[model samples]
Target: MEIILVVSFSYLSGSIPFGLILTKFFGGQDIRKIGSGNIGATNVLRTGNKFLAALTLVLDILKGYIPVIISLQYFPELIQLSCLLAFLGHVFPVW
Candidate 1:
Protein backbone atom coordinates (compact mmCIF):
# COMPACT_ATOMS: atom_id res chain seq x y z
CA MET A 1 0.00 0.00 0.00
CA GLU A 2 2.69 2.46 0.99
CA ILE A 3 4.82 1.40 -1.99
CA ILE A 4 1.94 2.08 -4.36
CA LEU A 5 1.42 5.55 -2.94
CA VAL A 6 5.10 6.44 -3.08
CA VAL A 7 5.59 5.27 -6.66
CA SER A 8 2.41 6.96 -7.83
CA PHE A 9 3.38 10.22 -6.20
CA SER A 10 6.85 10.16 -7.68
CA TYR A 11 5.61 9.37 -11.20
CA LEU A 12 2.89 12.01 -11.10
CA SER A 13 5.29 14.65 -9.87
CA GLY A 14 7.82 13.92 -12.60
CA SER A 15 5.16 13.81 -15.27
CA ILE A 16 4.47 17.52 -15.02
CA PRO A 17 5.33 19.27 -18.31
CA PHE A 18 7.25 22.18 -16.87
CA GLY A 19 8.86 23.17 -20.17
CA LEU A 20 5.52 23.26 -21.96
CA ILE A 21 3.83 25.27 -19.25
CA LEU A 22 6.61 27.82 -18.86
CA THR A 23 7.09 28.37 -22.58
CA LYS A 24 3.37 28.77 -23.20
CA PHE A 25 2.94 31.12 -20.28
CA PHE A 26 5.92 33.33 -21.03
CA GLY A 27 6.62 32.92 -24.73
CA GLY A 28 3.13 31.99 -25.91
CA GLN A 29 4.58 29.09 -27.88
CA ASP A 30 3.62 25.51 -27.79
CA ILE A 31 6.83 23.73 -26.91
CA ARG A 32 5.80 20.61 -28.78
CA LYS A 33 5.57 22.50 -32.07
CA ILE A 34 9.16 23.69 -31.94
CA GLY A 35 12.59 22.12 -32.12
CA SER A 36 12.67 18.53 -30.95
CA GLY A 37 9.03 18.54 -29.97
CA ASN A 38 10.00 17.38 -26.53
CA ILE A 39 8.80 18.74 -23.23
CA GLY A 40 12.28 18.92 -21.78
CA ALA A 41 14.69 21.79 -21.20
CA THR A 42 16.34 21.37 -24.58
CA ASN A 43 12.99 21.85 -26.29
CA VAL A 44 12.23 24.83 -24.11
CA LEU A 45 15.41 26.42 -25.40
CA ARG A 46 13.75 26.73 -28.78
CA THR A 47 11.70 29.53 -27.30
CA GLY A 48 14.85 31.69 -27.16
CA ASN A 49 14.57 32.11 -23.44
CA LYS A 50 17.60 30.74 -21.67
CA PHE A 51 16.15 31.66 -18.30
CA LEU A 52 13.00 29.64 -18.88
CA ALA A 53 14.98 26.70 -20.18
CA ALA A 54 17.28 26.81 -17.22
CA LEU A 55 14.33 27.00 -14.88
CA THR A 56 12.73 24.05 -16.60
CA LEU A 57 15.92 22.03 -16.30
CA VAL A 58 16.16 22.77 -12.63
CA LEU A 59 12.53 21.95 -11.98
CA ASP A 60 12.79 18.74 -14.00
CA ILE A 61 15.76 17.58 -12.02
CA LEU A 62 14.11 18.52 -8.76
CA LYS A 63 10.96 16.66 -9.71
CA GLY A 64 12.99 13.47 -10.11
CA TYR A 65 15.25 14.10 -7.16
CA ILE A 66 12.70 15.26 -4.63
CA PRO A 67 10.59 12.17 -4.91
CA VAL A 68 13.58 9.90 -4.44
CA ILE A 69 14.64 11.98 -1.50
CA ILE A 70 11.22 11.74 0.06
CA SER A 71 11.06 8.03 -0.49
CA LEU A 72 14.50 7.60 0.99
CA GLN A 73 13.62 9.59 4.07
CA TYR A 74 10.15 8.19 4.64
CA PHE A 75 10.18 4.92 2.77
CA PRO A 76 13.71 3.75 2.24
CA GLU A 77 12.55 0.41 0.94
CA LEU A 78 10.90 2.13 -1.99
CA ILE A 79 13.76 4.37 -3.05
CA GLN A 80 14.67 2.41 -6.17
CA LEU A 81 11.11 1.90 -7.35
CA SER A 82 10.24 5.52 -6.73
CA CYS A 83 13.21 6.71 -8.72
CA LEU A 84 12.49 4.34 -11.60
CA LEU A 85 8.87 5.44 -11.79
CA ALA A 86 9.92 9.06 -11.74
CA PHE A 87 12.23 8.54 -14.73
CA LEU A 88 9.58 6.65 -16.64
CA GLY A 89 7.05 9.38 -15.94
CA HIS A 90 9.43 11.97 -17.27
CA VAL A 91 10.22 9.98 -20.41
CA PHE A 92 6.72 8.62 -21.05
CA PRO A 93 4.46 10.94 -19.18
CA VAL A 94 0.80 10.16 -18.68
CA TRP A 95 -0.04 13.80 -19.18
Candidate 2:
Protein backbone atom coordinates (compact mmCIF):
# COMPACT_ATOMS: atom_id res chain seq x y z
CA MET A 1 0.00 0.00 0.00
CA GLU A 2 2.81 2.38 0.84
CA ILE A 3 4.59 1.50 -2.38
CA ILE A 4 1.43 2.15 -4.32
CA LEU A 5 1.06 5.57 -2.77
CA VAL A 6 4.66 6.45 -3.48
CA VAL A 7 4.49 5.32 -7.09
CA SER A 8 1.21 7.08 -7.74
CA PHE A 9 2.43 10.29 -6.18
CA SER A 10 5.64 10.18 -8.13
CA TYR A 11 3.88 9.58 -11.42
CA LEU A 12 1.27 12.24 -10.84
CA SER A 13 3.84 14.79 -9.86
CA GLY A 14 5.86 14.18 -13.01
CA SER A 15 2.78 14.21 -15.16
CA ILE A 16 2.08 17.88 -14.44
CA PRO A 17 1.97 19.83 -17.69
CA PHE A 18 4.08 22.69 -16.47
CA GLY A 19 5.24 23.75 -19.89
CA LEU A 20 1.74 23.78 -21.29
CA ILE A 21 0.25 25.62 -18.36
CA LEU A 22 2.95 28.26 -18.19
CA THR A 23 2.90 28.81 -21.94
CA LYS A 24 -0.83 29.27 -22.05
CA PHE A 25 -1.00 31.40 -18.97
CA PHE A 26 1.81 33.77 -19.85
CA GLY A 27 2.06 33.58 -23.60
CA GLY A 28 -1.58 32.86 -24.31
CA GLN A 29 -0.47 30.10 -26.64
CA ASP A 30 -1.07 26.40 -26.63
CA ILE A 31 2.29 24.78 -26.27
CA ARG A 32 1.18 21.76 -28.27
CA LYS A 33 0.20 23.95 -31.21
CA ILE A 34 3.74 25.27 -31.57
CA GLY A 35 7.17 23.87 -32.33
CA SER A 36 7.32 20.10 -32.16
CA GLY A 37 3.96 19.93 -30.45
CA ASN A 38 5.62 18.67 -27.30
CA ILE A 39 4.78 19.81 -23.81
CA GLY A 40 8.37 19.74 -22.71
CA ALA A 41 10.63 22.70 -22.04
CA THR A 42 12.15 22.65 -25.51
CA ASN A 43 8.79 23.21 -27.10
CA VAL A 44 7.96 25.85 -24.51
CA LEU A 45 11.14 27.63 -25.54
CA ARG A 46 9.83 28.01 -29.03
CA THR A 47 7.18 30.34 -27.71
CA GLY A 48 9.84 33.05 -27.41
CA ASN A 49 9.71 33.07 -23.66
CA LYS A 50 13.03 32.06 -22.21
CA PHE A 51 11.82 32.57 -18.65
CA LEU A 52 8.89 30.26 -19.11
CA ALA A 53 11.06 27.59 -20.63
CA ALA A 54 13.58 27.84 -17.81
CA LEU A 55 10.86 27.79 -15.20
CA THR A 56 9.22 24.78 -16.83
CA LEU A 57 12.53 22.98 -16.97
CA VAL A 58 13.15 23.56 -13.29
CA LEU A 59 9.62 22.65 -12.24
CA ASP A 60 9.64 19.48 -14.33
CA ILE A 61 12.92 18.36 -12.81
CA LEU A 62 11.69 19.18 -9.34
CA LYS A 63 8.54 17.12 -9.77
CA GLY A 64 10.61 14.02 -10.47
CA TYR A 65 13.22 14.76 -7.85
CA ILE A 66 10.85 15.73 -5.05
CA PRO A 67 8.81 12.54 -5.29
CA VAL A 68 11.86 10.29 -5.26
CA ILE A 69 13.27 12.11 -2.29
CA ILE A 70 10.02 11.86 -0.41
CA SER A 71 9.73 8.15 -1.21
CA LEU A 72 13.27 7.57 -0.04
CA GLN A 73 12.24 8.40 3.50
CA TYR A 74 9.40 5.89 3.69
CA PHE A 75 9.85 3.66 0.67
CA PRO A 76 13.54 3.31 0.10
CA GLU A 77 13.07 0.09 -1.82
CA LEU A 78 10.90 1.95 -4.33
CA ILE A 79 13.42 4.66 -5.18
CA GLN A 80 14.47 3.25 -8.55
CA LEU A 81 10.97 2.39 -9.61
CA SER A 82 9.74 5.80 -8.56
CA CYS A 83 12.36 7.50 -10.68
CA LEU A 84 11.62 5.44 -13.78
CA LEU A 85 7.86 5.73 -13.42
CA ALA A 86 8.18 9.45 -12.90
CA PHE A 87 10.00 9.76 -16.22
CA LEU A 88 7.47 7.57 -17.97
CA GLY A 89 4.71 9.66 -16.50
CA HIS A 90 6.31 12.77 -17.96
CA VAL A 91 6.46 11.11 -21.36
CA PHE A 92 2.94 9.69 -21.16
CA PRO A 93 1.14 11.73 -18.60
CA VAL A 94 -2.28 10.85 -17.27
CA TRP A 95 -3.32 14.43 -17.87
Candidate 3:
Protein backbone atom coordinates (compact mmCIF):
# COMPACT_ATOMS: atom_id res chain seq x y z
CA MET A 1 0.00 0.00 0.00
CA GLU A 2 1.20 3.55 -0.72
CA ILE A 3 0.40 4.65 2.82
CA ILE A 4 2.35 1.78 4.29
CA LEU A 5 5.38 2.70 2.21
CA VAL A 6 5.26 6.33 3.16
CA VAL A 7 5.08 5.65 6.88
CA SER A 8 7.79 3.03 6.61
CA PHE A 9 10.10 5.47 4.91
CA SER A 10 9.45 8.15 7.51
CA TYR A 11 10.14 5.80 10.38
CA LEU A 12 13.33 4.60 8.76
CA SER A 13 14.50 8.14 8.42
CA GLY A 14 13.63 8.98 11.99
CA SER A 15 15.22 5.86 13.46
CA ILE A 16 18.61 6.82 12.11
CA PRO A 17 20.81 7.37 15.18
CA PHE A 18 22.66 10.47 14.22
CA GLY A 19 23.86 11.17 17.74
CA LEU A 20 25.16 7.64 18.11
CA ILE A 21 27.08 7.92 14.88
CA LEU A 22 28.50 11.32 15.76
CA THR A 23 29.82 9.89 19.02
CA LYS A 24 31.26 6.75 17.50
CA PHE A 25 32.77 8.18 14.35
CA PHE A 26 33.98 11.44 15.80
CA GLY A 27 34.41 10.98 19.52
CA GLY A 28 34.89 7.22 19.72
CA GLN A 29 32.33 7.00 22.52
CA ASP A 30 29.10 5.11 22.39
CA ILE A 31 26.62 7.80 23.19
CA ARG A 32 24.24 5.27 24.64
CA LYS A 33 26.68 4.70 27.51
CA ILE A 34 27.10 8.38 28.19
CA GLY A 35 25.11 10.69 30.48
CA SER A 36 21.45 10.08 29.80
CA GLY A 37 22.25 7.20 27.48
CA ASN A 38 19.50 8.01 25.02
CA ILE A 39 19.95 8.15 21.31
CA GLY A 40 17.64 11.12 21.15
CA ALA A 41 18.42 14.86 21.38
CA THR A 42 18.90 15.36 25.10
CA ASN A 43 21.55 12.74 25.58
CA VAL A 44 23.45 14.08 22.63
CA LEU A 45 23.98 17.35 24.44
CA ARG A 46 26.09 15.58 27.02
CA THR A 47 28.60 14.84 24.30
CA GLY A 48 29.75 18.46 24.57
CA ASN A 49 28.83 19.40 21.00
CA LYS A 50 25.90 21.60 21.77
CA PHE A 51 25.63 22.86 18.21
CA LEU A 52 25.57 19.36 16.75
CA ALA A 53 23.06 18.20 19.34
CA ALA A 54 20.82 21.16 18.62
CA LEU A 55 21.13 20.52 14.93
CA THR A 56 20.21 16.88 15.47
CA LEU A 57 17.12 17.87 17.42
CA VAL A 58 15.97 20.24 14.71
CA LEU A 59 16.68 17.68 12.05
CA ASP A 60 14.88 14.97 14.03
CA ILE A 61 11.80 17.11 14.37
CA LEU A 62 11.96 17.83 10.66
CA LYS A 63 12.48 14.18 9.92
CA GLY A 64 9.07 13.56 11.42
CA TYR A 65 7.45 16.78 10.19
CA ILE A 66 8.59 16.64 6.57
CA PRO A 67 7.22 13.22 5.77
CA VAL A 68 3.97 14.06 7.48
CA ILE A 69 3.76 17.22 5.39
CA ILE A 70 4.49 15.31 2.22
CA SER A 71 1.94 12.67 3.04
CA LEU A 72 -0.57 15.40 3.73
CA GLN A 73 0.17 17.22 0.51
CA TYR A 74 -0.43 14.10 -1.49
CA PHE A 75 -2.93 12.16 0.56
CA PRO A 76 -4.35 14.81 2.89
CA GLU A 77 -6.20 13.57 5.98
CA LEU A 78 -4.66 10.15 6.24
CA ILE A 79 -1.35 11.65 7.27
CA GLN A 80 -2.63 12.47 10.72
CA LEU A 81 -3.15 8.83 11.58
CA SER A 82 -0.07 7.63 9.79
CA CYS A 83 2.35 10.24 11.05
CA LEU A 84 1.94 9.32 14.68
CA LEU A 85 2.51 5.69 13.97
CA ALA A 86 5.55 6.59 11.92
CA PHE A 87 6.86 8.75 14.74
CA LEU A 88 6.30 5.93 17.21
CA GLY A 89 8.13 3.61 14.93
CA HIS A 90 11.04 6.01 15.06
CA VAL A 91 10.93 6.30 18.82
CA PHE A 92 10.68 2.58 19.33
CA PRO A 93 12.07 0.96 16.28
CA VAL A 94 11.37 -2.74 15.82
CA TRP A 95 13.32 -3.01 12.64
Best by TM-score: 1
Clash counts for all predictions: 0, 0, 0
The candidate that achieves the highest lDDT relative to the unseen native structure: 1
The superposed Cα distance between candidate 3 and the true structure at residue 87, in angstroms, equals 1.8
- After superposition, the stretches of candidate 3 with alpha carbons farther than 4 Å from their true spots are none
Query: How close is each model in CA RMSD to the real structure?
Result: 0.9, 1.0, 1.8
The better candidate by lDDT, 2 or 3, is 2
For residues 7-83, what per-residue lDDT tens digits would candidate 1 score against the true structure? 79999988999998899898888999999898889888777889999999999999999999999999999888998
Which digits, one per residue and each the tens of the lDDT, describe model 3 over residues 1-95? 87777777767766777677766777788888989788877888887888868877887787778778888888776787558766786788753
Model 1, global lDDT: 0.91
Reference-based lDDT, each prediction: 0.91, 0.90, 0.76
Number of clashing residue pairs, candidate 2: 0
Cα lDDT over the full model 2: 0.90
TM-score of each: 0.94, 0.93, 0.82
Q: Per-residue lDDT tens digits of candidate 2, residues 1-95?
A: 98789878988998999998898888889889898999999988888889999999999999899999988888899899899889988988998
> Compared to the true structure, candidate 1 yields what TM-score?
0.94
TM-score of candidate 3 on Cα atoms, chains taken together = 0.82
Instruction: Report the Cα lDDT for residue 76, model 3.
Output: 78
